[model samples]
Target: MDQKTILVAFGGASPEHEVSVITSHQAIAALQESNYSITPLYLTKNGRWLTGETLLDLKNFEDLKKLEDSCTPCTFGQNEFGQPVLLEQKTGFFSKPKTTPIFAVIDGFHGSKGENGAFQGACEMFNIPCTGSGVMGSAIGMDKVMAKTICRANEIPVAESVDFFEPDWVDHQSTLITKIESLEYPVIVKPVHLGSSIGVEVVMNQESLIRAVEAAFKYDDHLLVETVITPLMEINCSVLGSSRAQRTSVCERPIGKEELLSFQDKYLNDAEAKGMASADREIPAKIPDELTKAIQETSVKVFKLLSCSGLARLDFLVNEETHQFYFNEINTIPGSFSFYLWKESGISFTDLLLELIDIAVEDQNQKARRIQSYDTNLLSQKAVKGIKGLKSKK
Candidate 1:
């Protein structure tokens, strides 16, 4: 039996570039002991797709320019048998290019085109099995406003807030501020399309809110300001499998130094390794069993509501005193694939990756089973004659 090649795709033109790299490395490490052959599909910060065995090492990333120079440029294309292949483009005029059959793709991206549905759409176009949410789900998951709106319409609890574009913030600062202030002071401001808390801030007054919004606009054109869950308790839970059949992992109460978990707190501090898995958290979240069950149930609901697949980590903000929780955001390609949560749920990292790959294969098979095209030639003589007068009539 031939070992299947899993393309672990990661990195992107995203603010969370480093975080994505860490995630890809962690996944590669886990898959090393497996029977599958791993191929590193590393997308550079400027958006070039490269692949090579060197990219599989975490240390090479210390100097990104050198690392990018070392890898081979590659892309997805079909082989002679119409099977998907990772085609490594030739570097020299006389050099023959190489091709590697891609069995499936493990999405290790965090933000931007990598996680915002673009990369997933590429995989769909190639008919390659891709792990994680589909195009629509990934796009919605990346946009904070869209996710909240969908959740609200589905009767899922979410915080009330106002969202605006950069032009609105610049042209009508006072008006936007008024709308945001309506959410009240000490609200949390976040970049609408970013993750890893890249441009998230908690503001106490109008002045600080203005400053935070100005700063966040640097990362994204759109911004969301919502009422902060004071006496905040951040609970996270991971969900696995496709929308049709999924299960939730154990909940985690991420312990942060401040009300909001800063990027440094989550990834930077003590992050010589262990991407998101490095974050301080109480696994199985010491909350009551009933609350945990409710959270788990809600997590699964939102997972299906967003049409998420493979795996996702849903974060919730709970009002500690009231014991009320509201959906915050969903990480479709969550850092480290949220395997830590699954670990607490009794699934090892290797098992989790294998399950995700299996789900992707199953999804692709299901799609293949459908009637994708008809046998009719629309431009045939009879069909052309039938439509000849239609255009003129219309």
Candidate 2:
């Protein structure tokens, strides 16, 4: 059989764009020796989709202007065989667009539309397999309030939070502040639609809370203030497979340099920007066996509960002394694919990628097996005649 084309899709209009690029590059490198041909689908920060051989090289990204000028613009389309393809739009006096059949897409995005179901929805529209969660799962995973509300309803522990849109804040700042302050002091303010702690801030006083909220508004219009878990120790567990069947990897305890894991703390530790693998963390976290087991079990529960497929990393906030934990959030397309945790679980990076691809293919196959559309011709001559009669009557 011929080698399949795996489109490594990444980058988006989000604060975590660089982190997404790093994750995609890491995935590309791991899949280099696999039985598949890799294609780069680099979505620029300004929202242009471009792809080329140059995009496959990380060095080319050093000067984005030069890189953008050299890459070919591309879009999704159907080929002669009606197969989904990545059609390259070449600009020239005598140039024809080239189409490459896309067997599947490796979604390595971290935030914004790329990870919030928009890109996944596009793939669904084209009837192609895309790795990671589907539209509903991705949307819920990216929304902090919705995810937490679902968890809370499922008897899963979650911190109390008050969410408000920009307009709500503009019109009812005092009322919102009163509601948030009810969660008590030292609450954490976060942008609802972002991940990687891009706009997360731990606040104490009302003055500091207002300042943080104003600052976070720059990143997102939807904001939430949640009760902070004091003496917090963050634990994250990765779940693989789908709702039908799945397993959780060994839990990891991330070591933040400050109060909470900030964007810089997660992605800026290494000079080479080695993605989440370079972040400070303790694998198979030294927590009690019971705590670890609880986290692992809860991770799988949340994954299946949210209808997540392929893989997801669920983070939990723990009260170090009490050993109590609360589900924080789920990252559908986790940074570095949460491969570091999986690595410690005895699964290699390449194997993890392969497993994700297999899950996506299985999902697509399952969908194909179902009735996609009605076979009858609704626009038959008889139906047309009836329509003509209605028009004649009118």
Each candidate's lDDT (Cα)?
0.92, 0.93
lDDT of 2 by residue, 1-394 (tens): 8789999999989899999999999999999999999999999999999999999999888999999999999999999899999999967879888999999999999899999999999999998999999999999999989889889989999988899999999999999999999999999999999998988899989999999999999999999899999899999999999867999999999998885997787888888859998889988799999999999899988998888999999999999999999999999999999999889989999999999999998998888999988878769999999999999997
Minimal lDDT window, size 10, model 1? 264-273
Instruction: Give the Å shift of residue 152 in candidate 2.
Output: 1.1
Cα displacement (angstroms), candidate 2, residue 365, comes to 0.5
Give a tens-digit lDDT track for model 1, residues 1-394.
8899999999999999989989988999999999999999999888899999899889998898999888899999988999999999987899877989999999999899999999999999999999999999999999999999999999989998999999888799998888888888879899999999998998899989988988999999999999988889999999998956989999999988886888987997783788888888898898988889999999999999888999999999999988799999999999889999988888999999999999999999999999998897888998898898788798
Top candidate on lDDT is: 2
Off by over 4 Å in 1: 91-95, 382-394
Q: Which ten residues in a row have the lowest lDDT in candidate 2?
A: 256-265
